[model samples]
Structure formats: structure tokens, C-alpha cells
Target: MEETGYTVGRMRPEWGKGGAQSLTFVVTEDCNLRCKYCYVTHKSKGKVLNLETAKKFIDYLLTSPDIHQSDSAVLDFIGGEPLLEAKLIEDICDYFKIRAYEEGSRWYWKYRINISTNGVNYDSDEVQHLIQKNSGKISIGITIDGTKEKHDLQRVFPDGSGSYDTIHKNLKLWMSQFDASTKVTFASEDLKYLKESILHLWDEGIYNVSANVVYENVWREGDDKIFEEQLKELADYIVEHDLYNKEYCTLFLDHIGAPYEKEDFNNTSCGAGKMLAISPDGNIYPCMRYYDYSLNHQPGYIIGNLEDGIDFDKARVFLLAMYKYQCDDECLSCPIAKGCEFCQGFSYDESDSGTNFQKAKYICKMHKARVRANNYYFAKLYHKTGIKRQNFHWKKELLFVLDDQYASFCSYHNEKISDQRMDIELVKEGLKFAEENFMKPVFLHSEQIADEYLTDYEEVEVLHRIPIQAYREDLPFYDYQIIVDDTSIDLLDKIPFQSNIIFNLSYENISKLSDMMEVVWRKTDRINLNLSNLSKTSDLSEYQRQLEKCAYKINEIEKHTGMLKELNVLTDIMFIKEHEGCPAGEDSVTLASDGHFYVCPAFYSNHLPSIGDLKTGIKIPNEELYRKDHMPLCEKCTSYQCENCKFINKRCTNEVNVSPAFQCKKAQIEEKTAMKLQKLLEGRYEFTNIISAKEFEDPIDMVLDGKMMRGYF
Candidate 1:
């Protein structure tokens, strides 16, 4: 049977947004240089996007109801080297410029065009003339990786002599020809020497750069240790130099430093298939990464008749389908959900399947680090809301991250190489980003800055305590952890949690643990609920008084573990529904797993005690990686919401209550998600209570301080 896995929920992208600000037009597949990592399929193909089809694609794009809404659009002419088919690109741009005014307001809705070139064959006068004519409408995105040694390591001509001189010369020529408004980007393999690369470009008199990371797994895997180390190195470097300074030009940095009020970007999801891309052959695609459905396998030049071949919506569905396969691991359920990639794109896979073997392997090595982050994030929950309850139960020797689903999450954390689904689209501007950013910076150290600029900005986590609502006895392992008694905790302590011991404990552990601790919703209880009637008053009349009486109860159901859906944060919210920030769009509520759930493991004000048990069938191997007290972040973050560590309580710190690394990362993601939600819903409502990440010192302090920062009215 073909497993569709389980039905995750429907996604609802914010309407009216579509297409990227940039689009790449392939001029030709024929290249003067041969980089091995180039698309595997591009090797045998001698195809090019012919002139006529290119024009039609542009026409469709200009007239596209979907494309025009973007703030601006840039046409990036790419190739095997865009200059190889420079003449075709010229024709395409010339045609668009001359016709741009001729078409309706739709055609000129602020569209700017650009092209990407390798600097080979770029000095021709005629080509320069055409570019001069349409320079206002077009800017070129170029590739220049490091110095001569690095550049030649990959980008070389047919016979293999380094072409750095010619490329730089042409780059100078391009710089002299265009002004700064023309979006000039410098790309490379990763985000390494951005400062040096930018300075390098500046030395050549070019201003404006857009850096990108190379995406190749073309989809292959196996370098889990290497790539993770590479990324970790980069992140450490970022932390070391504080390179991601609050610069307006750097979007990621800008986002990182956004004020609490400013960080809110209401919509959490990107508009996938909406914004369309038009290839040189006039076939439309969601973005440049996709092969043109109209031209990918074309045996010859295609022209004029290309309009008949594109299916925009179907492709959208295909890509949207990929997201469904991701995030079933532990990160999503962790209190901090947004900082991580949420999908396999960050790591390459063995095949087209979207498995992150690196994610599996690397996560195995450093997941404790992330659990540290999750705990750190959960600690922030308390810092933000100022509610206190035990997340990590600290016995004399063991710290428990008390959740049920953590086993699988821990297993998936390794960045496994799987044959699951994959994202086939390739990000075109990889090399340039690496070249510009990864190069070393000689001047950054000597540069003078105001003391205020050097000031420290503490990072904060967004914490979520979700409650599971539905009842499902048939499949009862959603974050279920055997709440063993002190004696049982001690008895189990001697078991040495190997797979065999885990297997042995899986059977009787549930009932045995039940005798010790209370779980959220067992099927035996009739009052278990689902999505439709979440408000306790909405239940029977007997429940209404109880719901109204307590400090956090909804109805007769004094305790509940409602499933935390994609739309909302806590599954079993105890504080106040009014206190919950707001739904993260309707679709957000649906991402939470169904069946019985709990409002995080903290058990502060929730109805349900806890959820599933790890002994059943979760994938966590090193269980100690999930505890809050096991983490360093928990000690630092006092925010009640921020410190409500899920993954920690469910797994890691369970053995020692000390945090692992996952807690830190989870904190960052939650903070980002909350900021995103705040940005998204800010103008629509006027909520009296909301806490930002910056206000708190740490989880312990947040609890001590109690939640009135920002002075909620």
C-alpha cells in the first residue's frame, strides 16, 4: 500500500500574494565552462530557451494577474553562462521594453528585469548597446566565487584555465554601466565570508549584493557530519563576530533584531505557486528552481506556440505536497517551533526523497545542543507569561523531559538520508553567495563603531504549551510518557534505557506509570473533546460553572489536553483564551496531531496531567536530551511561556533535568514564530496582553518576575 502517512491538515496561504521579486530566464544550456555540480540533467541536454518562447513567457508574465501584485519583478537571465546566449536575452529584454509601454497598466506594474552571467563573453559592444538601451528595466546578477584559487576550483573554461580576470573585467564593465538601484547580488556556496565578499565587490566599484547558499543534494546525501559541522562553524562564526549585525540591508539580520512590535509578520507560510516564473521558452513555473514543464525535455528550439503547454496550478499542488511530509519529528511539537528549517531543504538527500541523512546523523551528534535550545525556549515561556510549573522533573540523579512523542523526534533529529519526497527545484544562485560571504574579511576588525552598536541584544524564545483534546485509545502514543512513581523512576533508573530495555518497558510501563502519575486524556474518559466544542462552557451545563469558576478552567472539564493545532499555540490552554496571542491563521491549528493531547508537560493549570509515553514507539534514542533543567537556557530564561519545554520534558533532560542544545534552537524558533504571528495579526486586533522576547532575562527569572512586562492593561 502506498502510504500517504496520516492526513496532516490543509494549508491556507494568505491570499493576493504570488511570485518572487526575481525570475531567471535560461538563455542556453550550452556552456563555455563546465562545473561538475551543475544540474545532473543539464549535462546531456544541449537545449536553450529560444527567443520567441522567451517573449511569450514574458508576455504571459506581464499580463499575469498573479504576477503583477508583487512590489517589483526582476528578470534574471541565466544559462549554462547567460552570456553564451546573450543575444537571445537582449532580444527578450528589448522586446519587453518596447512593448512594455504598449501594453496596459498590467504590463508596467513596476516590473524591473535582470540577468545572471558568468562574465564569459561579456565584453561585446553590440551586447553592451542592447543592455544600455534597456538598462533601466534590467540589472544583472553575477557569479564570482572568492579569489583565483577558489574560483578556479570549480568555475573554469572548456580547457580549464581560470577565467577570473575576464569575469572581474566584465564585472567592472557592468558596474560602470549601471547605477545602484539595479539590484546587484553576489552569490556563493554558503553564508561564510559575506563581509569579505561584499568588500571584494566594492573594491571593484560595485555596490548592492544578494547572497545565497548553494542547494545541491541535486538531491544527494552522506555528508551529514561535514555539512553539520560546516553550518555549525558558520553559526559559531556568526555568534563570534556578531556578523549578523542589525543592518537594514541584511533581511535576516533585520528580522533577527526586529522590535517585538515590528517582528510580527502575520502570515507564517510563503505563497508557493502563486508568484509565477517564466522561462526563456515561455513556460511558466512557480519559481526558477523548477524545470520548465514546457521545455525541460525539448529536443529542439521551441517558439511562439509555447503558451499551450504550461499548467501553473498543478505544479503548485506538487510543491505544496512536499511540506506535508515534513515536521512530523520532534521539533514541531517542541514549545519552540519556528527557528528550524521545518523541512529537508537545508540538507540534501540520498535520492529525490526529501530525507536529511545529515539531519539524522548531525542531529544525533548535536541534538542535545538543540534540546538545550528547546529548554532555553521553554524557559522563556515563563519569562514571557510568568506562570510557573515543573517542566523538567528532577529526581536525585535523573532529569526527565516528560513527553510521549519525543522518541520519534529524537530518531528523526539525525538528519537521515531517506528516499521520502524531495524538492526537485534548484536554487540557481548558489556559488555567488558563498564567494561573497565565505571569503575572509581583513578590515572588519579595524573598523570603528559606536559603543551602542556593540551593545548586546539578548535573544528570546516563544514558548507554547499545547493541550491534546481528542480521544483515541486505538492509537494512544501522541507524546505519551509513562509517568512512573518515585519507586518506578528509581526502578526504571536501573534498566539502562537501551532499545531492549525500552522494548521491555513499553508494554507494562503505561499501566504501571499510570498508577504513579495522571495522564491527560485516556479513552476511558467520556468528556474527552475535539475541535468543534473547545470552550468548556460549550460543553454540557454541568461543565459551564466549573469552566467559569477556576483561575484557568474552561468549563466542567477542569483539566484538558487539547491538541495544539497549527492555528493556535497551546492544546490545553489553562491561563485564559483571551491570553493566548491569537490563532496563527486557521490552518495553523490543524498542524497539531489529533487524538488526546495536553497543554505541554508543565501541568501548571491544565486539566490533563500529561500525554503518551516514550516506551510505546517513539524514536528517541538518547532520552536525556530533552529536559529543561538539563539545559543551560532554562536557568537563563524566566519567561513562563518561553520555558515550557516540551521536547525537553518529553525526552532529553529527563535523566538529569539539564538542557541539551535542541532547547536553544527551539526557543529561537518559537520566538520567531510568535514574532511572525504578531506581525501578521497586529493591525487586525487590539489585544491587551502580549510579551516580546526581549523583555525577559531567562526562564527562571520570568517565573520570579511574574508576567507583567510591557505592562499589559
Candidate 2:
């Protein structure tokens, strides 16, 4: 809480130098009840932070003399049940109060004191009195999921009976005992229970509250749909009851949209190291991840050592690494640029790479969902925003066709191929097989990539070597594959034969995207936001290389797609090294973002079975699957915006044409709903074979309905 215009609070929170300003005092973790969803193992095994740790932590908190003036350090007393060690909590509180009087102002150093507890046990009167003495600073946060039945089903005592009633009774008693507001929260398997529980709490006269959706064993907010609807319903209810202006805060809402507290409020991205967390285990982690076993976390990473021995500079370094996960090139140019924050430290704990690709995929899907939602919002908000968009109509824009192929070509740039780590022969075979059997001539986007490092290669590339970008400056690559699709095809003639059907994407709104459903528009307080944004953050050298590899493949298809199709071959023809000018060798073309040349990235930098090493120019196991011939969903299911990935088979399931559940469930839903969408589209214009009212269980079923049977089926 620095003065206006000077917001660098207390020279930055230093670890070790500042006595443990943030104390998480865990009383005896041993508890009477066990939650089935508890991340930690039940029958508690970890040592509770005893009174000794508590005292030293207080001593540490006292050292933060500068911040103490502005705000006291936070002392969050957590436990299996803080009430289990109720006396210790009192002792700790009393210790600090007495110290404040003895040391004068230093003892009153902690600005906030919070206690997390399971409300099965009634809080002691002494504890209540201590809270009152603190002048409303000590608000106890408690848990209550819903009606007794669901609550018991989720968490229970050792005997396995539902403990909801006991907890509710204890909560009522605690609320009655303490004059201050209690924040009653819920953790429900189904969000419906959360709503019911909040209603129950309101009925009990405990109007003040805060709620957080509990992610499962994995640190996720679970299903976004159910979570959003339930939470929004909660927000609307609070506003209706005039409880919206209270001190209660919901992070779920804060994430999507928080209260507009400041005039400068803007979008809040993930602030991983800046918001920071130090586990009771003494290891430093980013944000809300206090519990999780990523063994690399050490005491040194602690932002400030409780014993006044830790270093802040190192912690600052840790913060820098978090937001800047060095990965793919998508961050710079992706439409959803703001949605690129990632935490690599957590990945070091749970994933093979320090950066979690799986989580990235989840984030990507969620971001795509967010884009869809924002698009809808943008349309509604800016309806007369008459800027023409990509008219994905039947008009045969050459670039659009190439762009379609570019979008459809599953860029397998970084997928780690199985076993064949250094198979040079396979690389050669794949290159040869692709070139001779599937040769083509096409125009490529030969845009010059940025970065001053290319100064070294300019001479060689320009004088004797082949041009990278075909001729276009906006494109990254140039003449490599097809000549036909990019040619001047008659648009009027193509439109007469083309299916003007309202593809499933017409009905594919934001709701179809499970990650982003609502928008909160809350503004977060800044620490050094615009100066240190999420873009320029990271230390992950490995994932960066991998990401550049993927971007390379995407760039490759984007540029050379025209040439690839002219020879009656797909974009990634297994081999192409035999041709004189075709760039498909050890380092024929470098990734645009990162100047590294490798095989296709889907084999994850192992490069696809090399073109020159193949027995035939067609060396892929199921080459047809890479076409419309093998895609069960894409052939029938009409998610025009959907990215149908052949690389899905090789990367996720090792089958080139195999569709993961992600594709099957999502794509089919869009396809099946196209009929309803037809009703909407018909009003806009005359319709054709596109609006056939046939139910499709999957994309293959759509083929059974005959959307296109000539060349595709």
C-alpha cells in the first residue's frame, strides 16, 4: 500500500530479509473427517507446522517493518481442521498480540489473519473473542457444499456417514458466536449443489460469503459450463439480495469478471510468479498451487526465507520464468494474443517437459472457446461493425482454398515419434517417397521473418540457394508445392457445384467451447503489468524449441500448400527430397520463429519418417487417412472452422486418421446441429443441399447421408 504514484510496495517483497510476512500455520493436520476429493492423502501423514514453526514465522513477519506500516503481513492458519488445534491457534494469536505491545508497533505487523476450517467442529469462545479483539480483521472461511446428502457424499467422517448437518450446525453456532461475517464456501461435484448450498447458507442468515470452485485432484476448475452457470447464478442472486456490495469475493468471477474496483481496470491475465505462492513444504511455486508434488521445488525458491536467509532477487527470477514459457511461435501472431500466459514450474512437477503441453492444449481449447465467446460478444456489441470478415462462402478465393488446405494439414512439427529417435534412413525414405510419388508446383508465402540473426544466412540464401517465400512478402514460405488451387479458377462455376450448406460452424457458438462461457471484465491491481506483460516471460529452453518446430510446420503448409496439391498429393507428402528444388531434407527449411530445421514437428522434432529414406514416395502407414478418405468425422461432420488433425492419430493415438474424443464429441455436435442452423441460414438466403435434415452420430454417418459422394466419399 504505497503512496499514490509510488506503488513499488516496500522495495518488493523479499524472502529471508522480510521475516515470514506470509505465514501459513497448519495446526495438527490430523482430522476427524476425510474428503474423498482431498488432494493430500487421507489419514494425514505430513507433520503439522507445530507451535515452533508458528513462532519463528511470526518473528519473520515482524521483520517486514516497512510493509507493516502500510499493511500487516498475512497469517493464514490452515489445517485438516484449524479447530482441531484450536488452542495452538489461540496461543499463536496471543503470542503476536503480546509481542506487538512489547515491541510496540512491530508486533501488530500482520495486516490480515485468515483461518480455513471445516465447520464440523464449533469454534472455541476464546478464538471468537480473539477475532473480535482484532477488530473484524479475522474472518473465518468455512466449507459447506449443499444439502446434507451431496455434502456427505463428497466428504465424510471415517465412518463414511454424511457430515453436512454437523458442519452446518457448527457453522450456525460459529456465526452466532462471532458477530463478524463468516465466509461460507462450497466444494461440490455438481455445481447445482453449490447453488443449493449457498441458498441454504443465506436461509440460515449467514449472508456474507465467498465461494471458490474446487478443482479435482488435478488443479482445474473442472467443467466450465456447469461452473460458469452456477457461479453467475450465485452472482446474480447476491446482487438481487443486495449482498453484492459486501466484502465477499469469488476468484472464479474475478477470473472471468471481477468487480470494477478501479478506473484503470482492464483484462487480467494469469500472473504466475508475480502473485506467487510459498508452500508449507517450504518450496516456492506460482499462484494458487500450494499443494502438488513437483519435487524440483526447493527451499531456496522461497520468495523470502522465514528465517531471514532467503533472497528476493532469485524469487524475482522465478517470477520472470513463469509467464514467459518459451514455447511455440503462436504467442506473437495468434489472434488470441492476450490469452498466452502459462506456468512452466508447475509443469516441471507434473509433466515430462517443464512446460505442460497437455495443459497448453487445454488452454488452447479454452482460448479458442474464449475467442468464440468474444466473437459473439463482439458481434452483439459491434453488430454494425461492417468490416467484412473472411467470407467463407462458396466463392473460390485461391488463397482461401490454399488456406483451407493449410488449416486442414495437421502440422506434425513437434510430436515425439515412438522409439525411432535418430532414424536417418527413415528421414531419407520419407523425403524421397514424398517427392517422387507426390510432387507438385505451388506458390508459397515468402514473407521475411523478423529477428536480426538472419543476417548470416542472407548471402547464401539469396545468391545460390532457393528462395524461401515464393514471391509474397506477407507469407513466410514461397514456391514449394501446388500450382492449381492457387490459380485463377472461375468462382461462379465453382459456386454452382459447391455445397452452400450451413456447415456445423454456423451453429458452433461459444457454448460449444467448454472453457469460456461468460465474461467478468474485472480489473486487477497492478504490480508492474504493462512493463512486464505475460508475453516476454519464460526460461523453458526445451518447449521453446518444440514450439518453434510446430510453428515451422504450420508455416510450411501455409506457404507451400498450393504446390503440394498440384501433384494430387496432400500437403505432407511422406517424401520429397528427390526433387532438385523441393526443400525437405536435414535442414532444408528452418522454422520461421526459431531458426531450426528438422523433420515434421508432429513426430515432435524427430522429423517424420524421412522422405529420402523411404521405399516409396508414399511411405506413411495410412496415407489415405491423411486425406478426406480416412477422416471419419471431417468427411460428414461439417465443422468448417474445426481443425481436423491427421497428426491427432500419430501424436495422441499413433493412428494417422484416428479421431480423439475431443474431435468426435465436438465435431459431431456441430454437424448434428446444422439442421437447426439451416432454419436460421434459410432466412438470410436461398439454400441448397447443405441443409439436409439427417441425424449424424459421427462424421461417417454424414457420409451415409450423401453430403458429397463424388470425389470425397
Candidate 3:
């Protein structure tokens, strides 16, 4: 019953795109320095992986059918200090490559040698020679906590002195040779140095920083608050410096603070049992953590030894079968449990009953604090970049954001674009891309731009809409559509008869909205309201009352005046039986003035990453998340009228597939109101699909409660 298709949530970076099988070799349990936070408790100069033993393991690995199944492999080397036995590692790697080639193994061509070191002997001639010998196949991640003060606080020598000077001197040489990231750890004492340490690393030209707090119970009572404050301070600095794209900190990733999907069920935190780890004495453990020196209470969890093959029963039943269900019930159903990280080895070490299945929850509060800080970071980043959080409802038609005026009409009005006319040739280029891709193009621009550019693309057929502040009767009325504001609805009387006009209702003018809807209904049935500004804390009952009153008023007018046309939120859903939510990436894409294709106009206006450019065509990363089947909450939702806005979803929930609380509440209210409207218009229209009421207000609650199955539609 293993689930598939869910991502590893965002704690770990998605590296090794080819999905390499990890084979870790604990070369030695010896080191050059005794760091205070070192996990290896039993560092012995006596224990070292001999060349013959490593060769034996390599032969077994290359000949095994299970190892050959992987298309790629990572020959990982770990130690109290991996570089301490640099010559042994070099010989092991050389022997592995030769044996794999001799056996015609797949790993010979696709393999990488990964090492994590303390950087004490990084500048040594032996280590330099080893690195040079295996130039293209090796990746080393050196450990440097942060600044001098931060590093000295936790990572010190046995003599109780800081090793920062030596590590700092060697850092320049390491940076000169490799553009690799440094690993940093945050403990209770060094929590205050979090910001400066990250900034210091950035100053040292190591822009990619992978830093995290220890998952031990060593955290003090108020350490979570201090952690939160430091993260916030770092977030502000990152925003102010505008180094988000240029720099990276694992804690502030874009994919954090999101709900877990159903497919994410039973997912383990790290690749523990799936990966292979061999000790110096030739005994095999699941990972480095299960090695005797790293564990506290028990001996190594040995699956087998080099003398015998792997014990499949112990490996599979006890190790490979590890999943999230094995954790406590609170963790099993936790809403913010997606990115919560845990160590399988640590779980076994800290478990009260000596069972690895009972995952240790020592990092729960620290993770929560990180999630909050991540939320603040992303919110501020989105705000600064003009990324809107509301649902973008542009139906299947492709929207061309011609200029500032057009973008303003379609966007949430967060930031007004400067008045700059897009080049006519750029429009032609976009039109050409759309035509070749078989997309229907609709242009949103001012009247003057339309006048100048509409004739430029005579070969392609385009639907152009003009956004005007006031009515202009003398304007040419060919096949053009006009987007009229709420205040200008009274000018409909002067508009030509049977014209296709879209009336944009700004809800700020609530009193005049009813009157304007009547005028818009009389003039034309096309109506669009900017309901994105509706607050989640607003009076839902009053909003429902207002909607009911408007629907009733429109119904009464149609009945008394004998008008054939009647358009409102209630009747709109009745006419369309199927779910007609905004399919931003699927049905439609927006081509901005920059000649790039965005998911929608909002994305372009907000400065979000475009799906593709003209040269690349369209390439959306994680495109499956945009579809309804992958959306856990929306897939089970009965709210067919829901906009299912990806922009809003990502903004509020940090995920595109999951709906936000506000969006879920709003969709629920609309669906309930639509059900009532269906009853009111029972005999008037022959509805194909009846709107059914749901027992729950939030779709996510039903999902978490296991009340609704996925793909409920």
C-alpha cells in the first residue's frame, strides 16, 4: 500500500534528478579535532575501513541485482573526518570504478562520490591529491557553522578552543576549487547568531546555505521564540538586500508551511532504510545514524555483514517499511506535518521502547517556529514583488496583457503598472506563438493601443477588449468589447445596442452595485465582479443576505419587465452545469508585454516566474500540481463554482494544489448559496446538474477526517 506521486515536501532539496541509489561507506571513526556538537561519540583511531574490505563491498554492490537496478549511484563517504583517511577513500573510489567497468555495471558511467567533512584537513596535500584524482565524480560539502563567534560557540576543539581560524583559512581554498554549499547547524546557545552567520556565509561568496536547528530535546523553554525572532530578522535582511534569488537558506524555502497531501501519507522524513550504509568493520546499517558511534543507547542496527549477504527480512520489514503512520497519532494527523523532519536513527535512539517506528517529536515546536517565519518571509516577498493572492478568473481564453491599463483591469489592483505602450511587433510575436500553439487570443488594452496595434496583426484573428474609465460613443464599434467600471455603468444607456460589454463591479460601491447590476443585465449579460478584496473576517451572513437580495432583485426585474435576459451569480451557475473554474495553466495562459507566457495575467502583473518564454515555448515546473486530480482538497470539493485559483492557493497556503482557509470558506458559502438559488429557480430552468449541499464547511476538514475519498467528483 505504498503511495506514489507526492513530493518529499520541501525540507530536502530535490537533487540528483536521475534518482541515484545511495551507498555510504563509513571510512573511519577517527578525526583531527573533537568538536563539541560532534555526533560520533566513539571516535577511535583503531577503526579504519581497510582497502580489501572496501573492495569486497564494491564487488558485492556491482554484482548484486538490486544494486544494478538503479540507473545511477552515489558512493557516499562519511567519518569523524572523512578527509582524515583521504588516501583510503581515493583507493576505494578507484577500485570501485575499475570493478564496475570490468563487470559492465550501469554505475560505472553514472555515479557520484559525495563526502561531508569538518574542513580541518581540507587544505592538506593528501586530500587535495584525492580530490584532483577524482575530479568530475566528487562533491564535497564542508561544515562551517557561520561566523567566527557562532562557530566557536558550538564547534570547538577538545582543548575548549575555537577551530574557526583553521576552517576559515581553508574555506578560501575550498571555495576556489568548488562552488559547493556549506552546512550550518543552530543550537540553543548559538540561536542569536543565526542571522549574522548566514549573512557572513553570503559575504564569503557561499550563497547557497543549508542551515537547520538540531532535532534534539536540548532546546530550552523560550528557545523557540528566539529562533523565530532570528529567522524573522534574517528574512527582513534577505528581503531588504533583494538577494532571494541570488541567495538561498533552506529554512526560507518557498514550499514550506503547507498542508500534506494524501499521497504524502506514509512518507519517511529522510532516505534512511532505502539507502545503504556500511561500517568500518564491514557490518551494514540503514544509514550513518545507525552506526554505533552516532547512537547513544543501543549497538548498531546491523542488517548483515560483508561475510554474508544482506538480510532481506531485517532490511525490509524493520527498515524499508518505515513510514509516517509509525509515528504518534498527533503527528499522523498534524495539519502542518508535511515538512516536519525527523531522523530514523535518532528516533530509534530516543524511543522509550527502543523502537524506531515511534518517531521522536523533539523538533515539533522548532519546526512550527520555522513555518511561521517562512510564512512571514514569503508574505513579505510576495507583497514587495506585487504578487496578488486572489483567484485569477480568466476563462479558457488567452489574455494578452497589452499595457498598464489592461493589466490594471485584470489584476487585483495591488500595484499599478507604469503607462508604457507595448511594441506592436511584440504583440505580433505573441500572437504568432499563440496561433502556432493553437490558443485563442484575447487582448486587454486601452483604446489607442488597440487602434494602433489591432491592424498590425491582420493575419491572426484576435479578440480585443478596451478598458475605459468613461463611455465614448464616437469610438469605432467593429467587433471590439469594452470593460466598463462600476461607476460608469450609467453610461450603458449611451452605448450601442447589443454591444458586448463587460461590467466590472468594484464592491466598494456596494449600495450602487444592485442598481448597476440591473443596468448591466438590461444592457448585456456579460458581468464580472472583482470579489478578490472580500475579507475572510467579513460578515458572512450580511454578505449572503446581500447576494440573496441581488439575486431576488434581478429575478423580480426579469419577471416583471418580461426581459428574456437575466444574469447574476445564481443564474450563472444554473446555465453552466459542469465545473467551470479557472484553469490557469491548463486552459489558458497570459502573454505579457515582456513576451513571456505566464499562468495568468495576475502572475505577469505580480512579477511571478513565467511558465515559459517565446523561445522555450511552455515548460511549467511541477505542472501536475495545477491539475484537479492532484489537488487533494479541490478534488473532493462539491463547490463546482469555486474559482480554484492557484495564485491565491500558493499565496495563503504555500502550495498551488491546496486551497486556503479564506478561499475554502468563500467557496463553501458560494456553493451553499448556489444550492439555495437552485431551489428558488426550480421550474424556470431545466438544470442538468443539481447543486448538492455538503455537511462540512471546509473541504480540508472532510479530507483530514477521512469522510470523503479523493476524486469525489
Best candidate according to lDDT: 3
In model 3, where do residues sit more than 4 Å from their true spots? 1-15, 66-68, 318-323, 387-713
Per-residue alpha-carbon lDDT of candidate 2 for residues 1-713, written as tens digits (9 for 90 to 100): 11121110012223234433454555555777887755444336464556666666555545555223323455667656666766677788778776666666643754466676777665567556656676555657667655676677777888988887777767655665553244433343445566666666566665544544332223245454454455445544543454433323332221221112222122223444443343455433344333442234321224554555345665455444422243344443232344333444444344454332322333443333333332232122112222211211110000101111121112222222222222333333333322222111121121222232122211011111112122223322211221111111111222212111111111122122111100000111100000000111322233223323323333343355421111101111112211111112211221211122223333324334532222222143433444444455554444443344444445555665555554454433433343343343344434433534445445555445655545654
lDDT of 3 by residue, 1-713 (tens): 11121111123454467378899998999887787666788899999998898888888887877544478889999987888899999999999889989998888898998998889889899999998998978888888888999998887777888989988889888887787688899988999999999999989888778888887778989998899889989878776777765776787755554455555665778887778888888998888899999888877788877888688778885544445556676776554565687888888888887677778888888887786676556545554543321211112456787775562343154344467666788777877666444355787775346556545233333566766553365543234576777656656667666544565554465556566666676667555544545545654555566666667775666577754354334555656554556677866778877778888777777778988888888888888787667878877776776777778777667788888777777668766776776676668768867888688888877766754556663
- What's the ranking of the predictions by lDDT, best on top? 3, 2, 1
What lDDT does candidate 2 reach at residue 393?
Answer: 13
TM-score of each prediction: 0.44, 0.41, 0.58
Task: Give per-candidate clash totals.
Answer: 173, 80, 0
Candidate 1 error regions (>4 Å):
1-24, 43-46, 59-72, 177-213, 218-272, 275-284, 292-309, 312-322, 325-713
| Cα lDDT, model 3, residue 79 | 89
- Candidates, ranked, TM-score: 3, 1, 2
Poorest stretch of ten by lDDT in candidate 3: 1-10
RMSD of each: 20.7, 24.2, 17.6
lDDT of 3 at 513: 56
